[model samples]
Target: MGSDYSKDNCVHKPPMDERNLQGLKDYLINYNLPDGHEGYINILLYGMVAAGKTSIINTFFSALDPDGRTVTCVPTGMDPNSLTLELKTYKLAKLKFWDTAGWNAMLKSHVKPKELLRMILEGRIPIGTNLQNFKPTFPEEYPVIPGNAIHGVAFIFDMTTMDNISGNIMLRFQELQTIAAQICGHRVVIGTKFEKLGINEKNHAWIYEYKPLQQKFEQLSASTGLNKQCMFVVSNQWNGEHITMIKRILALYALENMIRNIDRSLKMTA
Candidate 1:
């Protein structure tokens, strides 16, 4: 089911500024590594199944490619079983995007929140490790103390299935919030598939233009203690004449949130 809003009432805006886009590109390219840290800034992406996390990463890379090449470095699919069965990391210059298996509420028995937090926070989970029936690995198992702690976490949600935001989902999200609070990293929510809600593709103002949609997320943020500004809605599957601009806009918002989280993390560590 979709929202009750109609297309006539929707708002629209001009395309994103070229200057701002360039600034974000430069920021990601020239991000400073913290003292004694040689690796890229680790940004963890997590969400339920079919939330389009992988597509978001691909879209980001496509936007950054000057040759306009479509980059699908990470594998992505719609399998109900987690497509990303491992802790995969994609590096773009100074930024490292880590994509984990989709969190299944049905598998809560095997994937407890605390254990998942440990795997993410300490980077203890081994690559290609399936989360189904998964056992938590202790920190001592590592030869050296894993220091690739995430500087930011992005929770991608399927906006088309907002009605399916069950109690189980909210509970898990709350657990993530608790972990982020403890680790001093920032959390942002990205709502994908705006087209499913009948949102016009050319309407650039859809991010915060629709009051009802904004209110729904605002209430969720209030309950989950997520920063209201961290929520963004975009169409990851938009394909048409203006596909490039749409993807670029989506990438801009995604990177903007990532940068905000990174800055927040640095301040907390300082």
Candidate 2:
């Protein structure tokens, strides 16, 4: 096992265009949403608190938005409790990004997690409503509208928590993916807080060669029941302040996978 990790990288070619972050950003910015019954594509970010879903959104805008500045377009932090208290939507680069309250496995059944998630997935839950376990938050007149439904999902897992996440939590994550796959048809697992894994700017270009990431993939596979092929690692803006060039490029690489997967799902259904 040591030799395998120490040997050549599993990924021969990295997906990132280090020199062309701007160009990549430009291409995605101009990219059109594939024709669908829905007026726009809605991608939901789901994970535990501190999973970095919000940061991922900030990462996308930081790297892709024309402003060329790092800003907290979305609030994020390291607290285990969710910073996002509501189901909210942010307009970005031709898609609707939904940032919902992080999963809390401890909810003792005021509203079951899967049941609430189903409500969210079907667009039955009202945006801007506080995500809660105290009661149902569905809209009284929310008819099944394609425009309001989720188009894709990013199942984010904090690299720091994958190995030790409780069995119950892992089960919830898997269930979330199962529900998401039923709706989106394709999936991407994002392992955030990846910067802690010994990858640095000098070597991030050759991320595929990093042995730790491969091991991390195994951990994710065990936890999420998703394979490495569909998983992408990202380290969002550190301390919610400086967004390094390396972080920007890596986040872009993950976004590219997500956009491509969304496009593929669209084609398969077409």
Full-model lDDT for every candidate: 0.67, 0.71
**Tens-digit per-residue lDDT, 1-270, candidate 2:** 223244353633544555667756766777676675445668888887777888888777777656456766776665454378788898876778888877774256467777667777888877787766437554345556546688777888778777787887777778877877676655778888766776665666666567878888877777667777788777674644456666677777777767777777776776
Q: Which stretches of candidate 2 lie over 4 Å from their true place?
A: 1-12, 15-19, 36-38, 78-82, 137-142, 239-242, 268-270
lDDT tens per residue, model 1, 1-270: 135444443333324767666666677767776665566677777777788888788777776776446776666664354377667788887877888777774255466765676656666666556666566456456432355777788878787776677786678677777877677467778778776665565554444566566665766676578766677765566454334555576576667667766766675666
Residue 150 accuracy (lDDT) in model 1: 78
User: How many angstroms is residue 255 displaced in model 1 relative to the true structure, after the best TM-score fit?
Assistant: 1.5
Q: What is the lDDT of residue 192 in candidate 2?
A: 84
RMSD per candidate (Å) reads 4.3, 3.4
TM-score (C-alpha) between model 1 and the true structure: 0.82
